[model samples]
Target: MKNNFFYGYSKQADLPEKKRLLFTEFMKNNVKINQADSATLLTGVLAPPAAMAAKKAGESLPQLKMIKNVPDVLFVPSATVVALITVRFSKRLFMRN
Candidate 1:
């Protein structure tokens, strides 16, 4: 039973590297300053390369169009603990911009 519960939570489990990737992607993809005109907020795990790329692009990264301005449309490589941070930090995203 404990294992089952733990397994159920696996989707939310995030490796340190995984969290770093998603955070990096979020910082890279969402560079818009205006809430009304910026891309959707993003969060979650990213493929190793994706994160590396995002880190490379840094603050100069471009915006994405897949999701609307809702912000929940994060580009995660897979499921992770990022949901919590993304859910709340979604609003904080544009502030720095």
Candidate 2:
């Protein structure tokens, strides 16, 4: 039987030193980006529904009249920004040693 170039390198530890380092760095960056992207997506998805609920609730309360008058186009971006900042701030606050 003939052996392929990658036949024995099944695990990351089996990779050459330089390649292993590069792979590890790539994975770390990928995970960080994935987490950021997930947060952004979650905020984006939740913002609209939240705005709608607020608008509905505001209709029955004089104190929330400002919420009822705000347009969705403006509300969504602002809500997303606030949500992302909250997520990042809370992570920093609680994830410390």
Global lDDT scores for all candidate models:
0.46, 0.69
- Over 18-76, each residue of candidate 2 has an lDDT whose tens digit, in order, gives 56776576567556543455765787688677866766777789877777678878876
Which structure among the candidates has the greatest TM-score? 2
TM-score of each: 0.20, 0.51
What tens-digit string does per-residue lDDT give for candidate 1 at 1-97? 3334334345546676665666566667767665432323333333434544544455353564333332332433322344444555766776768
* C-alpha RMSD between model 2 and the true structure: 10.8
TM-score of 2: 0.51
Against the true structure, candidate 2 has what lDDT? 0.69
Model 1 has how many clashing residue pairs? 3
Please report the TM-score between candidate 1 and the true structure.
0.20
Which stretches in model 1 have alpha-carbon errors above 4 Å? Answer: 1-12, 33-97
